[model samples]
Target: MASARLERGVVVGARLLVAAVFVAAAVPKILDPAGFAAAIRNYQAFPYWSWNGLAVGVPMLEVVGALALLSGWKRQAGALLLGGLTLAFVALITSVIVRGIDIGCGCFGQSEAAESVGWPLLVRDLGLLAAIVVAAREPGPLRAARVR
Candidate 1:
């Protein structure tokens, strides 16, 4: 019983962590779409024409997914969305490193001092992905075991 309770706690904690990450990542992009678009363009993963759309769309998705995770309704779906986004980020970051392109991660926001893409960023994204996967595997909040 205690083990179950502990597992539930871990799941809830992971969910909240992932939710916070998504929300944090989304807000800056939403607030400054043009800057975010430039950041996306720096990646060179997508065409210039698509930057604006992606800049707007990605942040919106992050907000919606984060809200869903926090609300405990459709949490699994949110986790899946976050997981996919994290995977894409890891891939993009990896590509930039492999290609020797020095650019901001464009993850948190579009700041002039945004951190450059590197292995640390890739590891962080992978960690978030792991958290999402763990949270997604658990039952919903109400079904989680409660410790005395």
Candidate 2:
């Protein structure tokens, strides 16, 4: 019984943490899409035209998915979206590193204090992936644990 409680505690903690990070990251970009667009341009991952649209859309999607995860109403869908975003970021950052591109991650939007793309950033994202993987592997619906 103790073990079960411990595991559930861990799952709840992970979901809260992941949701917090996504919400924090999304808010800045949502507030400053022009800055985000400039940062995306630095990565040169997508076409020039798509950068603006992505900057506008990605943060909104992040918030929606995060809220879903936090609320446990559509946890699976949220996990899928967040997992996909995390995976895509890993790939994008890896490509940037391979090409010797020196740029901030723009993870929390473009800022003087933005984290640069590097192995550390990759590791952090990987940790988030692992957390999401754990959440995804839960045996039943998360709504069971959701507070009324």
Name the best candidate (by lDDT): 2
Candidate 1: lDDT over CA atoms?
0.87
Task: Look at candidate 2 and tell me the lDDT of residue 97.
Answer: 89
lDDT of 1 by residue, 1-148 (tens): 6666677788888888888889999999999999999999999899889999999999999999888887878977887787788888989999999999999988989887899999988888888888888878665443643422
Please list the residue runs of candidate 1 whose C-alpha ends up more than 4 Å from where it truly belongs after superposition.
Answer: 139-148
| Candidate No. with top TM-score | 2
